[model samples]
Target chain A: MSILVIAEHDNKELNPATLKTLTAAQAMGDDIHVLVAGEGCAAVADQVAKAAGVAKVLCADHAAYGHQLAENISALVVSLAKDYSHVVAPATTTGKNFMPRVAVLLDVAQVSDIISVESADTFRRPIYAGNAIATVKSDESIKVITVRATAFDAVAAEGGSASVDALDAVFESDKVRYVAEQVAASERPDLSSARVVISGGRGMQNGENFALLEKVADKLGAAIGASRAAVDAGFVPNDMQVGQTGKIVAPELYIAVGISGAIQHLAGMKDSKVIVAINKDEEAPIFQVADYGLVADLFDALPELENALS
Target chain B: MKILVAVKRVIDYNVKVRVKADQSDVDLSNVKMALNPFCEIAVEEAVRLKEKGTAEEVVVVSIGPKACQEQIRTALALGADRGIHIETDTMPDSLAVAKLLHKVVDEEQPQLVILGKQAIDSDNNQTGQMLSALTDMPQGTFASEVQVDGDKVNVTREVDGGLQTIELTLPAIVTTDLRLNEPRYASLPNIMKAKRKPLDVKTPESLGVELGSKVSVLKVEAPAERSAGVKVADIAELVDKLKNEAKVL
Candidate 1:
């Protein structure tokens, strides 16, 4: 059985999450084909060719694919779905946006945000905001899944040639049209792809205090995150929020500052390998899951921590 | 323009869900149920569109057990004109739900369809997209802002990285995000009047749609409990442990 992985990338660089998807793809079997669809993603196709265990790379470069609109991508994926037994993509916004369409077109139920591979057609996914996990078995002919990228290791990039094939599928536009995109500009790693993340909570007080998190994140080379309370309070953008309603992150190290850990927030990041929490409240819920807890004001603690690291 | 808003019944968000001892599913013996919070936002958005004179009719629909009609009445209480309950005991898979919705769309032909991004109970954010694909219509998922202009609708979606704006023609599907709008509580008069609103109930057989299960649950288990860690006395010791012992920083 072969697995088809859709590569996530801009025209310039392949997202690191794509490699993680390859890891899950490899677990299914050795014959893994990566499909790179974009306006001008020949370089991305070349990069995927170097990834280990990749049998082939299919490149579908067309103007309609520049923004990866759900309509066009779903059409392309539906055409490609005929040749593969399993189709996989990282459970990022892009993958979640389009995979369901592919599943409906193919008449299969899409397995979403899977955290573990039980078997070829079985998987484990979080339910009730990660309060519980449900093991599911697919009864359909074709298995469509979106893997949680952080749960798997990224396949190593080694020199190899994956035969590139150009798919000849007609582009059909839907009612949706891409108007514009404004990507958040950050020097730190992207949260979804980052192995280490540092998040702030309401304990930080306001948006200006987020700079403290940026400094510590710079020291550890980690991505900055926030709790739902912080995001709701306007201390950070909603994209930076991590919780049941926000992004689910499982990094190597997760440091939470000034955040009282609510159950919803814990559901998102409790799976991190190492957790450290700094909160003035002694009974904050975050301390329950933290491997290291510090009961102190983040205002005084942040500078000291940064200086010590420096 | 006429609008259709879909809602789901789920465990109230405030209640903590416990896994059954057998691990087959959650223990829902006597737990209170409420309208899915996100779906309430969807209903509120549709009602607001009508109140703002952009929509002439707002119809709500829910596909679940007969008891789900309570949620439909709640939607009506929130200003929805009417409701259609596709009664079923089993939770249909996303593809099946989309198919049933497609049948409804064929019959109703509403100008727009809005739904919660995903149900809190299943947390599968697929029905909206699947419905869009099945109908070959445009979809704006996880929308934070929506503006209607003549024949086109502009939506700002809440994506992981940031926000993205997409423009789609009418007769499209739009799933609401957290920031889309604050759902309003039903007033006393509206709650009393909701008892009089028209509600049509039909079974899966009556709808002539096959409710098939594509994926089956094998087991359910609670997440591993995280043990509490040591609390450092001060910043000096905390920094020392992080750098010297933990070696993460």
Candidate 2:
């Protein structure tokens, strides 16, 4: 069976999640084709052609797709969905925005975020805020699925020589207009893809205290994350939240500082290979799941940890 | 302008969800239930619009078994003008739910529709987008801020990296994010007043929408437990354990 993966990328570079999605798609089928739909995205098409396990890359470069509007992207995917047995995309905000539209147009129930591909139709996903795992099977002609990138390892970025083809399709809608975007600038790695992630919580007290995390993150070459409590308390922006309702990360090492591990917070980072918790409250639930538990005040621990790392 | 806000009754956010031993689904027997958090934000946003005089009426809708009416009443207590309970025995898939909402949208013709970005139970962030597709309307999902002008609405969305502001024409769909606004608690007197609010109960057949699920759950089980490991007395030992034992450093 042939599969079509909607590549997540800007015109400049492909999202690392796309590589993980490609790996998930490869597990489901051999004949996998990548669709790079964006304005002036030929570079992304060229990059996907070399990604391992891809058979072909279809580049649909158009001004209408530059912003990845849901109305336009859904129409584009629906138009070409007739040729594939399965359609997949990474479960990023962009993919979540458009994939459901594709499902409704196709009159099928789209699988939200599958973590494992049991087969072409059956897959495993988390539900109830990652407290439960549900194995689901789809009975539709074309299975529409979103892959949780953290659950799958990324495929090799190179070693394939798939042919790149231009796809002439444009669907523009006048109902929506892009105004502006304020992307958070960070010198550290992206949290979702970083190997090491250090997060703060309510115990960080205020936003200014995040500098302590920044110092430690700089030493570890890691990404900075925060719990929902910290974000809700305005200690950090919403983008930094790692929880059931926020971004999910499964890094090689996750250090949760002064965070009372709520279940929602645990849902996001419990998959990390190594978990370390530092909290003043000895009774904090975070210590229950932590691989290394250190009960201490973050203010004192932060300085000590920074010096130790140095 | 009239606004439509969709809400869902999910297990209370504070409750620890447990998987059933039979593996059929999550065990919700005698568990506390409340309005889904994101949907509460949607309701709050709509109520705020009405309070700001941008919206004349705010109508809330919920689809589920009769038990979901509790959530509808909760929304009414929070200042929704009316409530619509689409009664059904089984939980339909996201697409089916969207189609039902589409039928309501056709009947009500509200100028704007707001819903939660995702339900806490299924965590399927699809219904609002699917409803937007079925109605051929624009959507602003994961909205942190929403401002309604004469014929347009500016939605600041919380995306992957940061925030994006998109303008959609009237009659658009919006799904709320966490930072949209802090939802307020309903007062006791307001709760009593909500009991008198007009709540219409309708069936899927009444809307002429056939509801069925295309996906079936093969099994449901608890996530693999991560047992606690060694405790470190100090920062030095913690760093040593990471570099030597776990080797993640």
Which is the leading candidate under DockQ? 2
lDDT of 1 by residue, B1-249 (tens): 999998999999999999999999999889999999999999999999999999999999999998899999999999999999999887787888898998888889998999999999888899999999998879999999999999999989998779999999988899999999999989999999998999998787877988878799999999889999899887788777877888766
Worst 10 residues of 1 chain A by lDDT: A167-176
Best-fitting candidate, measured by TM-score?
A: 2
lDDT tens string, model 1, A100-195? 999999989999988888788889999888888999999888899998887888888776778888865657585778898878998889886687
The candidate that wins on lDDT is 2
DockQ, candidate 1, vs. native dimer: 0.84
Candidate 2 residues A174-251, lDDT tens each?
A: 999999999999888999899999999999999999999999998999999999999989888889999998899999
TM-score on alpha carbons, each prediction: 0.98, 0.99
Off by over 4 Å in 2: none
DockQ of each: 0.84, 0.90
